[model samples]
Target: MSIRRRLGTTLVASASAAVSLLSAGQALADDFSYNPPGTLVSGSGSGRFDETIYAPGMRFPIEEAPAFLNSQVWGHGGGSGPGGSQCDVENFSYPWWDNYCETRSWDMPLCPSGQGHQGQDIRAKSCEKNVHWVVAAEAGSVTNIGSYSVYITAADGTRYDYLHMGSVQVSVGQDVEKGQHIGKVSNEFGGTPTTVHMHFNLRQNVAGVGNVYVPPYLSLVTSYQALIGPPVEPAVGSLDEVSCDAIRGWTQSPSSPEAPIDVRLYFDGGPDTAIGHPFLADLSREDLCTAIGSCEHAFQVPPPLSLYDGVDHVVHATASDGSSNAPEVANSPMTMNCAFELPSGVRRRVADLDSANAWHFSPFWDEIAVSDGILSTIDEGEDLDRTPRLVATSSAPETLYLVDGGWRRAVSDEIVGVAWQFHPMGAEIISDEELAALPAGKPLRARPIVLRSASGDLWLVDDAPGPGSTGPGGLGGSGDDGDGATPDGDGDDVSGSCDCVVGRAPASSAWTTVFAAFVAAGVARRRLARGRRGTRP
Candidate 1:
């Protein structure tokens, strides 16, 4: 028999849906960040929307640590110095900018404008030129060389260009491995030095667009993350239960999955203050086998006697395998209000709503109020498992619902596929009548906002903005001199920083009405505060 499929709806169904959903006043801390595609420096043209990572697994162009991916023309020590030396610490910091279409007169079909700058500019380890080594992003051969450019052509007809180098390492037609030394980053603009940075470009045969310069900023960011590894402590686990009897949780590092990591508990204070000795998370958990691809990563420890006082206390957990600043597991910083007088039976029920007990509900789930008095009078009638569980009807097996806390929330494809990383195979099959008995809760929503301003700032505004907050601005430079002309020497149609005429155009207002709707929803108060900055060229 054919069964009807029921799926969870996404919060980000459309731009309008996103605005309405985000306007609901549900706030969360920023966990991920990225500049939206086409959000370029003001006066620079609209960026291309091609999200192709042409050179997947490609090495970061720079061959050292702490490389800054800012614009050369608008960055410090360039045409528009942000009032500091090139070696300023802020210049080396992150939230990198995209300069591919940053104002130039080149035939770039992919850019919103038919003509624009053709490549991305990357700053080396420091302000100095010809010191940091530039490596081959992909395994390819040096096809051609110019006074200030070296081109590597992969077997797939994908061209990788490296510009403005001091010591040219590889010769033309020479085979080189990925990450092989190609040259040193410099400011050799065919004799006249422009800026001490590397101009990198990616050219490939796009199906519809033909041979054109694709966006490399996203690709570079991906490869760079692979090179440097995840931020500080990238632990992937969660704190499951906390009670007067004992505290329970699990943790594992993606970097080292096979080995068990240590989980430390802190009370009242943050990670700096540990209440008791660290507990080794080596116990096996059946659910973890599918959730995290590992089993022996569970931990259960008794609450310290000192926490038995009537006052409520907050507890946090951090995983450690040697790295400093180990990240806190999910559902952490849970609150404990257990007193010695509370019966052991009631303690378990209080722990079942552990997250609700501390207002630490997952961003996917809405907050529910559960008071101490409510927990003390709990009568153990039916033996129901309060832990999160997946349920589906045999009549409509495809439709999955997350049964938790006497309520059922439909699980969407995105929720199961990405947000919570839940495996649908673990869902418990039940009769349709049984599934209808549970009370319905609000639809689950994954937190993360992708907001585009009237100005060309496409922000991934994750966290809640303060009263006077502002979106992360562009290069915030006053100059319009973006890699003015193509330096002489390269036979190909490549471009870089040079002494040439530059022009500026007014900022595009086509998106103003669309952006206004978001502001009206009060989801983008930060964008409304700041006036439009630069015009597109």
Candidate 2:
């Protein structure tokens, strides 16, 4: 199989859950950015690497590469040579430039970084400097711009570092977008420059340990495709929300004006369609709207269960630098719908804590998951559709589903945290805070649940049946319509009346067939007797 396919097919451990978000925001929010338990190699780094930790919400570091990279030439999995070492020279059949987390670099006594490769190594199509622009993987403040290295720390404390940078564009303490150009690719170690290759690494904070290295091969490989055309964010909810009052608003990308970040919207994850007429005076988000310029586009919600068929859908948004080629997911926030569906028969009881609001529900589905954030019933597979699943209910053994599972919120804005999980019962809402407290790499306990909504309504999602019906009794019992509206109430009577009674069959009608059978037999016997008497005379 091709290298990228191999990497993509090898599903990361469930521990590597969540690659994107389906929130009201427009940007893509993924669960785990770099695929983890990343092929561990002993020779890439010249030092002791910490535990294999997954960093969620990361972006690919390289901004511009071929739309489709030569997967066969270079990718994860080391090259072969003596002792399966020498990643570059070992595979004569394969190009030397392609290697990630390779064990071949183990004995590079010259490279004292570590024993194993801690990051992904990327080389431009040909040996060229100041051509391939390496950008920030995700928007974050720059820091620790070293001699041959640079680090961009995301708001969530996830860190991205690039090595072998020739000319740096961003300074420490500066903010950047997902694909903002930061520098050119070249060997930059001050004294001795190695190959003209950019070695990329990621550092995510573990529970007790801090900033451990994870492989960026898959993340890089995936991001490499953004150059192919408008790339759909693999996971959803990576977008930022553009709020307006009339259940509608016009949004633009980059929040800039200079070379206003031009973009195209792939509504419902369809082909890219040019959105909006031109850049209007976008005063939407005065704070983070691009400084250069932006375009204002209007989006309206299709009717429920009608827009994209009532199931949650997405708008795979890709922002560009107005150039036909320089497009990526940097400034634009893809949007998702956060749909809230309530079950019938459950009493809208108030929770113990809040009073005014009853807990209605809003499940989060991840593009249009990017567009809206609400969730719907699980798909045909019953698998958790949304990455960083909103509610992974244990419907079957070892299977977590989004259906009958989601947040208990009356409104969308009430939901919080970088990620979330819920106990099957409504008793507790597992926040990221609680997750940090728990032991890492351990399974959360499963329980039948009753969730409370943001409006204080109790969501009885337990497997057991809900409280019995309180409607008008069926003819025989007390004919009270539980909510105090009797049969003779002064309301427009919408209830239909029945002509036949629900109980007791009529006795005569029931025995009609049997009575007919007896009479026919008697008549036959009498006719026979009369015929015999006449013949004898």
Candidate 3:
């Protein structure tokens, strides 16, 4: 069957969005946040949509109370920053743009010059989809529900657009109030899912100009501040082991990356030490992933960083607890960081589809290849039983996803989209003509392969082209940089300071909402928060 046919009904069929909008008297003061507690601004999606496709939208003057109150909608994640390749139009065709872009570029034809990323991308507390709520930022009427997005029109005629939802709760003409549950967070992007993030945008109908992008960062920050009060200490419970190439650690707290924005190591109490960002390390480590929902983290340094050059270096960690002035978690190195026995290359397989825990792939059934960063025909006689061997290492083409061919990927016996879903060895994507051209026994290519976001996971895609904004642990903003994310907020807030809205929200109740599980990553649907929660990867 076609990929869409296989996945259409798989996800989001049961998300609680089926509940209709409240009949009347919708409250106006939605002082509370719509996103669950601990949500972050991971990708910080650009509003480049207006910059590239539509006319310029109105910009909110951050300091103005009216704008702040009007733009009080919140995003889903905890991290934010200037990520490399946030607007990766290179892999795809022309005109289409991602949600966020700070350093604007419009040189490409059919694209405007000054328009940058307009909206910000928020992440649910975890990468797992569906668990997070896509609540209405303000009381508004649902105007449009396209395959890829949900457009809610606010009282002022401004539009708050939410993208990539697993399931849309509100329908056209339904009225919604701020913090009203509208949909669930998801990887749904029409057909092409772009990572697990909620792409939020604020559009204004400028009389002569159509709906345009109004910078929503300040309002988002204010909303985030209102939702999550003062920053608390990062929950860095313990250090596992340290090595030259990677620093392994865990947190007793709720760690997906477990608290702390950036984990820094001060070598020898000296001025310059190595800063190793974290990622999902060794998925086979069941104990950690089970107890902490995959809290295992590692900072793998690239070759050029001389910091790991052998001499004994004392190391301690300084972590930011997603707050402005929280005390840093000072943890001394439990063990020296080393690169010994590390894979040095990223290798994802049908097995990484190890969700649901029903069936698992044997190590031999899986394999790693030096992709040479381009698409290639699978080895002629390969099967699940054979170890994966690199057939294309010298080519410099970009890394590509194989056609969706796995029956096992659909845990619920439903197909999500085809992108990134693993197919068996023989069914490479090829044209019908190319299929005829192939040797009698060779497999034929059938569909388009998608690109995996480039995080700093050196194991599988270290050599893959396009070091994208999706950083290690899939949290956007490769923390390996000096300062992870600049506010890119409105007015003075754009500077290093995370300007708090003073008393917009009460400090006593720190995190307001409590989230449970995520939506299906591929199919774009999620179980109801009331249903059996899926284990987040």
Question: Where's the lowest-lDDT run of ten residues in candidate 2?
Answer: 410-419
**What TM-score number comes out for model 1?**
0.39
Judge candidate 1 against the unseen true structure and give its global Cα lDDT, from 0 to 1: 0.55
lDDT of each: 0.55, 0.35, 0.34
The segments of candidate 1 whose C-alpha lies over 4 angstroms from its true place after superposition are 1-34, 80-85, 230-537
How many clashes (backbone N, Cα, C below 3 Å) per candidate?
Answer: 2, 102, 58
Q: Which lDDT tens digits does candidate 1 get at residues 1-537?
A: 100110012111333323322332121112123465566666555777666565554678898755667677666556654644444554555557777787777688777788777888887655456668999887777999999999998655779999998899999989887789999988889887476689999998886678888888877877676566556446667887765445678889787897777787778866433332465677666777798897778776545544544567788887755443356888987887644321112112223344332322232122122233333243332223334477766555545566655655554332222223343454687775576566553222231111112332222211111111121111112111111111111112112321111222112221122223222322211111111122223
Task: List candidate 2 stretches off by more than 4 Å.
Answer: 1-60, 67-100, 104-115, 206-210, 229-420, 424-537
Per-residue lDDT of candidate 3, residues 113-158 (tens digit): 3445456555443233565577776556899999878998764566
- TM-score on alpha carbons, each prediction: 0.39, 0.35, 0.27
Tens digits of lDDT, candidate 2, 1-537? 432232244323121111110111112222112223233223332233223223322344656433111111232222221232111222212122223334443532212343455566665532344556887777677988989999987655667888888779989888777678889877677777354457777777654444566655555544443443364422111123321100123334332333223333444532222222111222223333344233223222211211212333454444433322333343343444422222111222223323211222232111011111111121111112122233211221111112222322110110111012232232233443332232211111111113333343333322112111232112111212131111111111111231211232222221122223223222111212222354463
Higher-lDDT candidate of 2 and 3: 2
Candidate 3 runs further than 4 Å off? 1-100, 103-113, 206-210, 230-537
TM-score of candidate 3 relative to the true fold: 0.27
